[model samples]
Target: MNDITISNNPDRERFEVSVAGKVIGKAWYKAYDGDGQAERIFYHTVVNEEYAGQGLAGRLAKAALDETVAAGLGIVPVCPFIKSYITGHPEYEASTVAITPAHLQFLDKALAARA
Candidate 1:
């Protein structure tokens, strides 16, 4: 198995994993600024079909969450995988913020604006 590399593409609002420069997985997120604070809401995470079962998703999750915490931003785990991942990882629990109606509204508007 080839070693995978993870990187954050802030413009795309995702943390991606690649094998020899070809992207194989991504964890998508959106940044919301409100209530005088900033948050990164992780909404989806995926790995290429052929890349499944290689632990790439977990890798992406770890890297993405780590970076979010390092950047001093709260994490709103809207994606089930991210929410579950945080559940088993106690270290990241401190930075997590539960999803609320305001977050949902913000996400709806942000996604709608893109469409």
Candidate 2:
């Protein structure tokens, strides 16, 4: 509920949201493999630690998702937070790549093996 500003930089193809001139959140996305798959984007993200728990990340995600929908792109949420957010918000479900429990198990195993 703060004075947040959201901007979509077409040149960079990312949407940014800031608070008081400080960038607190962002959604990075692009056309998949230069294919005209504008209806599908790969995402990477982070929310400022100071701004965590304020729902700022969700707000930013929502804005980006809305933009992606407007642009007709399905979402490939590579960020864990974004993936979790989609699970809770069914509105974005259709645009998401389903990450089942099996996927988590595999990821955990892969990470542990590397450690």
Candidate 3:
């Protein structure tokens, strides 16, 4: 497996990872209102089908989360996969904002719009 390069594409508000010049996965996230703070992150992530099960997505998510933490911002995962990732990784828990009813409402509407 080639080394993966992860970068924040601020213009696109997403984290992009490429291997051998081909994008293998990406995690989308942005600062948004979280209960009371505006700097809370709402993250969404995806891995290219061909790259799935190879841990590329997790790497991309980790890299992105690292950046957010460095920026001194907290995260609220709008992506189910990210939520799951956070579940098994308690180290990142302190940076996470619990998903509340308001967040759930937003996510529901978002899923519906995409459907």
Which candidate has the top score in lDDT? 1
lDDT of 1 by residue, 1-115 (tens): 5667999998998999999899989999999885878999999999999988978899899999999999999999999999999998989999999899999998899889988
In order of appearance, the predictions have TM-scores of 0.95, 0.71, 0.79
- lDDT-wise, the better of 1 and 2 is 1
Angstrom error of the Cα, residue 99, model 3: value is 2.3
lDDT of 2 by residue, 12-84 (tens): 6677888887767777665452234434343567777887888777888888888777767767676677777
lDDT of 3: 0.77
Clashing residue pair totals per candidate (backbone < 3 A) = 0, 3, 0
Q: Please identify model 1 stretches exceeding 4 Å from their true place.
A: none
Error of 2 at 100 (Å): 14
Give the number of colliding residue pairs in candidate 2.
Answer: 3
Error of 1 at 20 (Å): 1.1
Clashing pairs in 2: 39-72, 39-73, 39-74
Clashing pairs in 1: none
Cα displacement (Å) at residue 108, model 1: 0.9
